[model samples]
Target: MLVQVNFLGEASGCYSGGMQSQSSQSNKARRRKEGLPAITPEAICDAAISLTKEKGLEGWSMRDLAAELDAYVRVIYYHVGDRDAVTSLVIERVLSEVAIPSAASGWRAWFDDLLRGLRDVMRRYPGVAKRFALVGPGGHAARAIAETGISLLREAGFGELSVPAFSLLLEQTCQFVAQEDDRDALPSLRKSAASEYAACAGVPGGMGDLSKSVAHATTSESSLRRYYDDSFDFFLRTVLDGLEVRLSNMRG
Candidate 1:
């Protein structure tokens, strides 16, 4: 009788300890809830976009996102595969916001509008432009934008050269503005550019004086943005003019 009483007490103590442990570990990692409003891929993407907008693409992690969703990190994986998957979704979301203008006023006007719209979208997303430039959009929106851009080139008499033309324009515009979204990076970049230019100035066998001067001018945030925008516009117009030159050569 004494042994049985002791056994019951020990068993009760073990049960109590186990329950306490489970309760304490309830919110760790893959903690499932009863009704989570049906976590969809779209829902996961939305949360991820929101998070990236608040924190730069590199700032947030899977665990951080899961915490924001009040779910386990595993739940996010189930919906969106992984961090790259989330980034792809964000890129698609950002691209979808850019309006594809019709060639209403002419191909040049349309192209101008398209680039302006793209710049506006990239500026709105801050650090997103950098990520997009690095990742190079693997989503459907990327395909659509490329197709539309190539069609514009075709309209402008790019004919056989449309493919290369579209490629240059797309890469140049994204890379140019992507560098501009980096507000934090600009100040340091400016200082570095000034120092480097000063070091290189009038130094034989160095970057020519004019190139160094231009580099120095591009360091400050405001100057950097203006320089980027001016350079991008010049590049766009030059490429468009080249397409015309290509057409002329073909005709000749």
Candidate 2:
């Protein structure tokens, strides 16, 4: 005499029924075993950031990440939903790494510290710098940085009316830093441009002057660096001076 059992909507009465139900149950068990844990959105985002840093955006893939973490591709769907979510998270994480200095010091000192810290983080991850520039900051880090800037301006005697202008100044400064990061490769770009221009100019007789101008423009690295530094300093000082004037007005 044999007992009967039922599993997975299957009946098991004797040998044959028992074998069939056992097979069904085995299949269900296997499926259950294959399933991954409930990874959170934050964990998925962190994994994406690590992947992006290791392999770059072009090399990143859901399958690759799943394999790396010993997870099924479906597991990613439960957390991130899509590649765009991953990208948004990546930008957020990168920006979060930028530390806002304490408000203990004067506004100028605080701003300088924050900007320098941001610059350092951006330089560490060039891909983030490029991507964030295009995305335009909007997540937690962006909001925090924005609020900090607003507070700094307020402390420096800027009226609520002028907070927007200060925010714009900070944003523009960040944009300038992003643009300057690209300039690290500008010398090579300029060389390639000069070569192309020379090839075209040489084909035409009267374009010799144009070729000279291109060559001259590409030849001077000292001038480019000096100009960059000078322009950056001038812009920063001018903005600070404007803030000072605002503070004076508020004081009076």
Candidate 3:
């Protein structure tokens, strides 16, 4: 037997509990007459994506999403289940947009290209990069990327270390992106920190070179973003170089 929805209960219900009656025949007919589009999992996921792009993945709640769709909170639960479910769909959608580069570019170059692209995509969605860094990817798109990455490493002589090597490369890149996302979220704190770093360069008996470099990198928005890019590139290249050395050691 199908579950009965208490539409009246929904008006005052908690988001996690009540069933929405929007799927009832009478309500469906009413919605059609009002010209409201039918809600589906895809439509819910699409609205979630829009919310994520505007407010980051962690920023919005189920009520915010319902408001975005002009639907009741229970409607979201009725269609997509819960916040975690919607997040998974949002992650899948974001991952699908990242173009995996051709492996013909060789392992190092392929990763260089792939990581840059991944950063570009993840940065757009804010908290997503941090999620990836913390939990790694979960969906089929992630699996596809991982399969290719591991294959590339194995072919590059990482042998049985391919999985860890791939994990490290991707994790480090995502962590960098995550830091950027965090820093962007607190502009006042960032500016205060930047100001302190800049002041350090002017200290008597100056720490000159190191402090100057830090100050220059942190002093402005454009410089900071460029600093992140340049720093990530340097970090990625250094890891690739170290891995190359490790591969040689394994061979010897």
Candidate 4:
């Protein structure tokens, strides 16, 4: 299979050379201020994470992050390609914080704790869930989480070949909660969507009632906090019960 190449695009061999000639030195010189803290990739990642926490994935920009770090936008660019690059690093930092338990609590308990812990982290950081919505097991932290989940399922007698598939399902479920983990915007959205859906009901069937679904989402913080808490118990149990049934049938 042949792949199309764009000479003018980011992946081109000369891209770095062109960029260096244009602004590399100037960008470095701008950050050469006295008494200012050093700007390293790790520091940038930390600052990016903090900025995301204050606003959100979409809430913060490269310029916002630069301002936060007391550096120029080009300085940020020098470190990372763009806002997406910063967010990717931020996601890595977020996922790395999750530690797999040293002992097993059985598959169900393990997954429940794992999922809850991940959601808790996302809620604390604000934009992490949104950033990792499409982050599919690329980085080590995320891959390790998936691997841990897969191994637990295998030990629980799930189909050996099925672990990776199940990991995707688990990730999707986690992403669902994480994406909706928007503590700031979701409450007002919940209220507005409910009202809008109510008004739209009994009207002509023009567009689909999308807000109808959004309205079903819990509005209160307590409810959102329990979005996984109360319901995931039901969900996790249901899955385990079904799997046990499957395992028993296969045994017979």
Q: Could you say which candidate leads in TM-score? A: 3
TM-score of 2: 0.58
Ranking by TM-score: 3, 4, 1, 2
User: Of models 2 and 3, which has the larger lDDT?
Assistant: 3
Task: Record all residue pairs in model 2 with backbone atoms less than 3 Å apart, i.e. clashing.
Answer: none
Worst 10 residues of 2 by lDDT: 3-12
* Tens-digit per-residue lDDT, 1-252, candidate 4: 111222111221234446554575655566574556677667788888888778776788788888888887766655555666666677778777775664368766776677667766777677566556655534454777776777777776677645654655566555655656653566666676667775665555543454443344444556545654666666666766776687677567
Cα lDDT tens digits, model 1, 1-252, are: 011111111111122345444543564323345554555567776777788777766778889888777776755554456676677777778888999887567666777788778988877666677776665776465787787777777876778888887766677777777676664446776577677777666666547676566665665657756776777788778866776687778767
TM-score of each: 0.69, 0.58, 0.86, 0.70
- What shift in Å separates residue 246 of candidate 1 from its native position after superposition? 1.7
True-vs-predicted CA distance for residue 41, candidate 4, Å = 0.8
- Candidate with better TM-score, 2 vs 4: 4
Give candidate 1 regions above 4 Å deviation.
1-38, 126-135, 181-186, 195-220
Model 4 steric clash total: 0
- As for model 1, its CA RMSD to the true structure in angstroms is 12.8
Cα TM-score of candidate 4: 0.70
**Model 3 vs. true fold: TM:** 0.86
lDDT of 3 by residue, 1-252 (tens): 122222111212233323334344555587689998887777888898898889998999999998988777766666566676677778788888888999998998888889889989998898998888888667454887898889999998898899999999989998989898888899898778767777788665557566778889886678888898888889888999999899999999
- The most accurate candidate by lDDT is 3
Give the candidate order by descending lDDT. Answer: 3, 1, 2, 4
Tens digit per residue, CA lDDT, model 2, 61-126: 888877765565655554455565566667777777888788878777777777667766765554
